[model samples]
Target chain A: MPEITYREAIRHALAEELERDENVVVIGEEVAEYDGAYKVTEGLWKRFGDKRIVDTPISEAAFIGMGVGASMLGLRPVMELMFWSFATVAWDQIINNAGFVRYMSGGLINCPIVIRGPANGGTGVGATHSHTPENMLANIPGLKVVCPATAYDAKGLLKTAIRDNDPVMFLESTLLYGNLGEVPTEEYLIPLGVADVKREGTDITLIAHGGAVLTALKAAELLAAEHDISAEVVDLRSIRPLDEETILKSVRKTHRAVLIEENKPFCGVGAQISSMLMQKAFDDLDAPVLRISAIDAPAIYSPHLEAKQLPRPTDVIAKVLSIC
Target chain B: MPLLMDTAVTTPNFDTAPINQSLTSEDKLRFLRDMMRIRRFEQGALQQYSQGKIGGFLHVYIGQESVAVGTVSLMGANDHVITAYRDHGHALAVGMNMNECMAELLGKATGCSKGKGGSMHFFAPDKNYWGGHGIVGGQTPLGLGLAYGIKYKGLTGAALCFMGDGATNQGAWYESLNLASLWDLPVVYIIENNQYSMGTSLDRSSAFRSCLAERAAGFAIDWDTCNGEDIYEVRAKTQIAIDRAHKQSRPTVLEIDTYRYYGHSVADAKHKVYRSEEEIERYKQNHDPIRLWKARLISEGVLAEGKYDEMDAAAKAEADESIKFAEASPWPSEASISEDVYFEVDRQTIAGRTGKHFFND
Candidate 1:
């Protein structure tokens, strides 16, 4: 086994997929000679050459739309947006073209593309740069949304996303890119729509995804250490497929649940999860499903204010304790 | 002043370019027949819209038939095409079956898009016709991407992106052009300057004083303009652009100054608020591509007298048969509502199981 950071996992996935599949190509701003803005695609440009690792201009709409069109023909294009907030410029291409091409073409065309980038508010990047859009992107019928919480999951899920025969929104976060986790030395794959129980306990269920999974794990540890309470942390790797069985099974054992995320509270991922728990396992709950998310406002630029804005382990602990 | 004038009245002679030397009588006849078929099919589409059989927006490509027919004729089978919503003519020109196109317009299951996409979104991947994009200027980058794929795959083909005059003003259009030029992607950005973007004319919409093709100069892409109403001119200019693209992996911006005889859509009738009926009549009588081509063919002895009447009758019959097929086609079933959403898995199954649990039941 080898321990790797989330950034290296992404690089490993891209390098592996590019080597394995002749049709796979990566296109984005700063992906080539610059080694990606976040360094997630470091050294790929030199290894794969210009054709496989394309360097695009600062035109998000053109490159994203090009990715969609390229995927339709034969090439599997992995388009990286510098920040997920920039996806707004190419909304029509993502929502109308990539999301509906196969359906509109009556299954005649499939847009096998992956649009990935950091999408969170951890770095105090302000409202324009930080946008956790897994909820919104997952709402699209034709799109599959994936957000990984660990290095092992990042490598596995990204590989699966590239191999998928449909458009996928691979949401990454700058906060988690440097975090290390143990992964197998040999090739491995973690299927999408599978939830992982980071820490299992019987008192309460802490539901989260992506970076929030760490917050939940820390909160669960605190609950066990400080209060003599046991808490189970569930990491939802895929937002669209939404492994309902694992979520229900966890909540059923714990009897109390608290949804956590770094996105805006209104219509966020937590809102959907709460609604699902209410409809699916209402009687099994000892208390109403609670939610802990970022404050319902645009992310502020000040580091202190931004820290207060996003959900933390303290917030998760408070929500869990209130429910329990 | 020319700025405020209806340029369709003073239609330039697009036949000035030396025609393809190898062009034969069969090629001329094929163009005539295809152009006539587009005309007849659109006329039938208008009829269906009026009769409440066809719904949503209907943009009839009645006057600009030569642009699509001529440009498509020059493209190889491997070449890709993408166009705006006024696209029935282009779809037919690119060899999409008339019945499937008509069925798509009628919202029937047998349509090229299986009724999921109506008039605004028709796609036939088999022919490399990417779509009937409804959003103005949305297909520009997609077309650019198709060219990128061609270059990436090392294919000896180009992607032709067709847009209306208004779409030239879109951010995506300019972005795509800049990237296409910078990358030397094999792409031809065709601007069908039909004089108007909906009710607004080019003078009112475009800030540029020069031709639309000059927009390509800003990106260092090669640029030219042609008489869109003339098939020979459009073919000659586009063939050169297409050839330069495949050989040099360069992009070209081509402006086809054509006209629309009718309103922008069924809702915007001709001469209602946009212009006068007399103005339209002037263009139709003088600048009709089909009429001009027929005359040239007849004078050149490629087409005999009375042959046009036979072609017209045949085109009308073919269009009527397509309409009948569309009328008899089935509607997409209820089970298909969530189908085709994802190629890797079933979207409907996920949707159906959203709140489904043993405890809930």
Candidate 2:
């Protein structure tokens, strides 16, 4: 076992996949030579060469579509969108081509493509660069959306995504990339649809993912120490194929559910979770599902507004307390 | 093994000889039939749109039939092809069933995209035809990637990426062109310079009004410009481009200067503010490809006037049958509303069970 940062874990996964699969290649702006804007692909170019590690121009639509086309032709293309917000430039290819091509072709084609990038509000990147699009992508049908909180999970899930048949949207938060966790040295893959119950309790179930997962876990610890509330935390690793079983099971046992998300409150991942719970587990619930999310306004450039716009540990704790 | 199968078999590549010397009577007839089929099919699409049987942006490739027919005629089944929104002609020319294409235009479940994608989004992966993309210059890098895959897999296949003069102005086009040339990918970038990017003419929109092949020179790609209206010329030039691409393992650009009879889409009048009626008449009179090919066939005594009439009638009838099939096809069922949305495991079963327990428990 080795203690590694989330960024290093991702870099290791890329290196391993490139080493193992001759068909795997990476294409993105500044991915090669520059070693990625976030350094998640640091030192990959030297290992793989320029052919496998491509440095593309600022052409998101072309490169993303290139990934889709390459995947269709049996190459595993791992593309990086420098920032999550830049994905909008190629939304048509991702939504229409990469997402729907396999089903459109009647299972004749499988797009084994991984579009990985940093997402969410952090470090005052401003409104243009900062966006949490878990809910937006979850609305799409053919994409598998994965958001890992810890270094170990990042490595395992990314490996799974690169090997998966369908396209995977691997969302990483800038804030969590430096956080350390014990990652196994051997090869391992975390399945896409499974959720990990980080901590179990009986009073309330706190559901979160990506950076918010860590916030939820911290909130759970504080709730236990201060309010004597035993809060259960479930990290929804994959947003699209949400581990409904884990969330609902925990909610049923705890009789209270609170969803913590960094996106806007309206139509966020929190809303989808709450709706699913109400529709299926309404009778089992002892309390209504509470959702903690950022305010409705666009993320401001001001550090104070940016901080206020994201869900904090205190926000998750307060929501869990109110519901319980 | 069978007599019928042997007769159906044909050479995989275009002949290296000159077009007239290389093509047999059968080859000429097949090319003529393909061109006629696309022409009639697009004409029917236009009629259907006017009648409101089809909706959305309907871009018909009328005069540019030879480009698709000639270029695709040179390719094999293993080769990959991608193109922009004016894709019906290319799809049909590349051997997609006319009935399925019509069904797609009608947004029927039996369509290529299962009714999810309309005219601007036809896809036939089994045929190695990637799609009909609506976004300009969107498929360039995709085509390059396909070529990369072909080379990476050590397959003797190439990818043909098609775009319009309008799309050439897009930044993605330049990026893909640069990458393709830099990597020496097995790709042929074909520019269908129909002289218009929607309403703007090449002279007005492009800085250089000469051949687009000159633009390819800057990227160090082997380039050629041909008269797109002439099926023979297009076939000859494309063969050279495709051959150079495969042999050299490098990218080539073929600038096919062609024209469009209809407006940009079904909605616009064939002629409006952009070009004068005189210029339209000049193109129609001087460079009518189908008519020129028909005359050449008749002059060569390969086809009689009556036989040409019969081919026209046959094409019209086929187009008619396609429309009927498309009209009679079923719409996608509401039950499949969530289908093809994602490639997720069937968690619905567990979700449903847990959902029921959540309320009851």
Give per-residue lDDT, candidate 2, residue B8: 24
Looking at model 1, residue B311 earns an lDDT score of 91
Please give the TM-score that candidate 2 achieves against the real structure. 0.89
Give the true-contact fraction for every prediction, in order: 0.63, 0.36
lDDT of 2 at B2: 18
User: Pairs clashing in candidate 2?
Assistant: A141-B341, A141-B342, A142-B341, A142-B342, A280-B355, A281-B358, A281-B359, A283-B359, A284-B358, A284-B359
Best candidate (score: DockQ): 1
Alpha-carbon shift of residue B155 in model 2 (angstroms): 3.5
lDDT of 2 by residue, A1-324 (tens): 789999999999999999999889998989999998999899999888987999987878777877888888889999998988998988877887787766655444668899999998867878889888878887776787899999999999999889877788999988998999999888998877788999999898999999989889999899989999999999998886667888888988988898898888888888878988998789989888888887778888897677877888888877776766
Superposition TM-score, candidate 1 onto the true structure: 0.96
DockQ of each candidate, alpha-carbon based: 0.55, 0.37
**Candidate 1 at B62: error in angstroms?**
0.8
Point out where model 2 deviates above 4 Å.
A30-36, A103-108, A286-288, A295-309, B1-20, B209-213, B269-279, B343-361
